[model samples]
Target: MVLPRNRDYFQIFLASLSPMIFVVLLLAELGLEWVYSLSIITLCYLASFIFWFKNGTKPAAWISKGKLHIRDGVFGTDVIYKDRLESMRYEIGHKRAVAGSNAEEAEMHILVIKMKGFDEWTLPIKDLIEHGPNLRLYKFIRDNFYNLKLVKK
Candidate 1:
């Protein structure tokens, strides 16, 4: 089966350059006389660049024929079998009061799936998607996985 590509080069480029942009702004505010500020900014920029280059813009793919396989991660891919999934549910946040807060707040959209004979797993869709187009991956998985059972609260 063919997998769709969700890589957004533009987003990757912007993320990679964010560090430099921040550093420049900081330098402008601090001025050249504050050499230590410049040094700190430079160090932060380098670290940010390295992190973005390594983990940004990678897309995940899900394929199913006889079994289901999900490919995602920065360093390696995760392959989960169809039989392993016990239940899957789309979780929404509920309004709840917080300490020193007047308004209620909601949580994030999560896909909680329990593996057979194992502990439950929660996947946050908001954190997983690198770009807008990557949302299609979540829809694809939700639509194609017929065996998915919803967990009852």
Candidate 2:
């Protein structure tokens, strides 16, 4: 089974912009021309788009037989055989809103598969509207790994 990346555009934009706006303002305060500061911010955003958009073309994860494959980067891929998997967990990472705000931002739900004698693999959940679209894929992963762990006990 192959899984989607499940990226949200609004989150990415906010993440990339929030820090950028602050830095640009700081630069403007530190004697840099406003035009140059704005240009710098624009360049940074362009770089981010180049990096993220290009990588969105690849598969985020796949499972074949008992092997789990995860894409790390353009040339880095990690593979873990089912038999070597130790334990697993799912977690939601959140971004606490500013002190004055009454909101929290959720980044992505991550499924962590721990394999024996190797580093754990963290893969994002694909259960989003345009991604996995349901819990079917999530259940598929949980059931498979849970059953394996159960049998080991």
Candidate 3:
């Protein structure tokens, strides 16, 4: 249960800067004053940078006798027993639109796991890390597990 490396700085920079670019473009079109527009864009850029710096790291992975442990944040980590897992499946092509328009969309690939006596938990792997590594991890879990009951919605 080895977690992959964090995304590089260039990727994070582009992700943080794209929204500021959009805001600047919108302000220009609306004929807003230069100081006000610049301030807004600057504030947004800084906030995005701070958020990315704080939450973008991959957590440590540990495998005990019959359980898997993963820590993705500062709060409570996830502990899953190998025997209790009932099913695991990849849910792809889920779309979410950004505010203000239907033209801007975010696609997600979620990995949902159902445990024996526990309610299902869906992890949004796409937003946390790169797609290839996430897909590899999902396949690894699916192959190593037993019965996999895919839920239909």
Candidate 4:
């Protein structure tokens, strides 16, 4: 089965740039004297949003035909056959929120894959507020690939 990547780019973009948006609103409320700053920030956010929108929605990992196809990075993917896998594990991680902001820290769930002749590969199963950890994906891997070692993080 193929499992799509869980991250939503637009949501992440908005969350990361929310403070700038808030500042723009605050300046507007105070009568728009900070037009220069507001405009600059707004333009920056817009450009960033556009970039993410175009480049996001990728990094998908899945198992098929006894091989694992996983995203290596922003624009790379690597394939490892079942025979080459050493172990697979998962762990919970915390993502620190912006300091002095009202935002709270978020939990991140990462899946780690270890191969015989390659470095470990980590994939984010769940991150930010867009989605929760994909326990289903983990369980699927464990249940289907019973020959592969399941290790603790």
Candidate 5:
């Protein structure tokens, strides 16, 4: 089964703006002229499109042949085999806050997978839990993995 990328384009575009805004503000504070600041911001915005927006387009995850594949970036994918897994965990907490909201935050559901000889891999499954077609992924993990740990807050 494949879990396609669930991130929205608008969200990615907004996320890219944060750094651009900061750079422009810093340039202004440094007494740069309006033309120079505009040029710099334009460059930064274009870079964000190339790096951030492009990177967000990929499959979120997929399962095949007793292995789980997680796509993390433009050039990176983490593969977890069922046989090598040491422990599996599901955790919920305030690890990330909602964008542009100071007092309101969303609960992040993270799937923490620990393999025998590798560092633990944590994938935020908030989108999966809320927007997935079904709970097949959750059920598959629960049924296949042993020593499953669930932590809720």
Candidate 6:
């Protein structure tokens, strides 16, 4: 059983940064007309959005050999085995989180996995939205861990 990584977050991250990126480009060019710069930026943003929409999300993960291998868009390839799997939980939004967090940074259904003798981890669900719906992922985690097959790769 190989699970694949979702790359929807790549587009979301790019979209969020596009405005600042455009402003930087516009300002870097000396004496450029604001209107012209804005136009260029707008076009770039549209093009980038279109490109991502057309080819959004990557399926590059596997859960075979008793290990979960994922190609994270923000990080990189991450591999964790069954033995390391401890437990799983959900992240509370900033407002509801006991520790508190920025509302914008908090998203629902952020999967948190705990490992034996290790820190907890988050599986970004917002990034997976573009690839497809992720309701099934929760179920999968529940069913797998419920069986307590945490041992060895």
Best by TM-score: 5
Best by lDDT: 5
As for TM-score, the candidate ahead, 2 or 6, is 2
lDDT of 5 by residue, 1-153 (tens): 776665788877886787887897789789888898889889999898778777776666677898877664445676778888888886655357788999877655677887898998887765543223444345555655344666776
Q: List the candidates' TM-scores in order.
A: 0.49, 0.47, 0.48, 0.43, 0.56, 0.41
Task: Write one digit per residue (lDDT tens) for candidate 2, span 1-153.
Answer: 776556655645554555566667677788777788778878887876666565655555678888866665444566767887787765544233445667754444556777788788866543333223454345556654344221110
Full-model lDDT for every candidate: 0.57, 0.59, 0.63, 0.61, 0.69, 0.53
Query: C-alpha displacement of 3 in model 1, angstroms?
Result: 6.5
TM-score of 3: 0.48
Tens-digit lDDT track of model 3 for 11-115: 666767767877888888988788898888889889988776554554344556777655544333567788888777767767677679979987665668788
lDDT minimum window of 10 residues, candidate 5? 128-137
Cα lDDT for residue 105, candidate 3: 83
Question: Deviation in angstroms for 139 in model 4?
Answer: 4.0
Listed per model in order, the count of residue pairs whose N, CA or C atoms clash below 3 Å is 0, 0, 0, 0, 0, 7
Model 2, residue 131: displacement in angstroms? Answer: 10
RMSD of each: 6.1, 7.2, 6.9, 6.9, 5.7, 7.8
| Model 6 residue 16 CA deviation in Å | 17
lDDT of 6: 0.53
